[model samples]
Target: MFRNREEAAEQIAARLEHHRGSNPLVLAIPRGGVPMGQVIADRLEGELDIVLVHKIGAPGNPEFAIGSVDETGHVELNPGVERYGISPDYIDSEAERQLENIRKRRQRYRRPPTRAEGRVAILVDDGIATGATLFAAIRSLRAQNPSRLVVGVGVAPPDTVERIRREVDELVCLEAPAEFMAVGQFFQDFRQVEDEEVIAALGGESS
Candidate 1:
């Protein structure tokens, strides 16, 4: 999308100049976010890291996230949990199942993903869906008491962007396509970001 990832990163990088003086640490949500965060960090001359999380899929449909779980296994459920009259026990059970995936991802991605303690922490993802994952990551990062929390992405729906803005201290979204379907839709090269590639990028193994 937009020629390649560079173009999207540069566009998002422009919004991060204010933090350039202090050099915020970029935390890319693994997979699609690694490349994007690597570019932003390069442009701003900041350190790059990775934030790992897993979606808490709905019971029947694993692809649909009813919530999300972070590296530490903290779960945040959707409003539907209450609105749809789902039980807390059910939510807890689903969260536990997702936590296993989060643990595996963290082990595979980074032996120990660094915490953003008292640092300017930027949360980067290729994009946001219902924002369940982003929200969980933000909540987890808040516990570290980062000096700043920024949500950066290539694109998202306008309403989702607004929701993210409310949760994060700032938002650096490039495009909020009105008819947005999936994050891959806006990308010309929406190829799957392999786990090894994500590690190479965030770990600086890739040149």
Candidate 2:
């Protein structure tokens, strides 16, 4: 397990060395992704920015994601939603609710969304669990027409890594263990990431 996000970032940054000087943009899914993105941007000499996406939780099990929504109100539903008996109306309302939250988050960042046109865009998170939000982020970023899209993370389930691999040009994951439980299980210090830290990271200040 990584000692912390810093160590994880260092490893991901090394794997992404080839992208250095390519004018790549590291757009992190806040708040956990900010620290790692900071290291990657500094190491690759790339621009840092935020990409907002939030999970749409399943009914009765709010922690279980039924799908995810991006900043642009684009929704991507899990195929398993039918198995869960989730309804279209629920999905529609949840997407709206999530879009509202994403709006507030964008305002909090105080920077216009970065245009991904013709430049490599690397989306980083501390780790991936359900991967619903990452999937949503990828689809939304794809709409921006990035020259190339990359997924860099500390750890994820093997299945998740494979699924995301097909969606992006490159996938750099430090660990992809079988039988994963949660993202935090792979980190020794997986604490909650706060808004202040995200702001500091965006401003190029150490948090």
Top-lDDT structure, candidate number: 2
Report backbone clashes per prediction: 3, 0
Q: How close to the true structure is residue 175 of candidate 1, measured as C-alpha lDDT?
A: 88
> Across residues 17-111, which tens digit of lDDT does each residue of candidate 1 receive?
88886778899887788888899998888888887777877667789777887867688886666666667788788787778777877767655
lDDT of each: 0.81, 0.90
Model 1 local distance difference test score? 0.81
Give one digit per residue, the lDDT tens place, for model 2 in 158-183: 88888999999999999998978888
What does each candidate score in C-alpha RMSD? 2.1, 1.8
Scored by Cα lDDT, where does model 2 land?
A: 0.90
Q: What's each prediction's TM-score?
A: 0.91, 0.96
The list of candidate 2 runs beyond 4 A from truth reads 204-207
The top-ranked prediction according to TM-score is 2
Which parts of model 1 are misplaced by more than 4 Å? 204-207
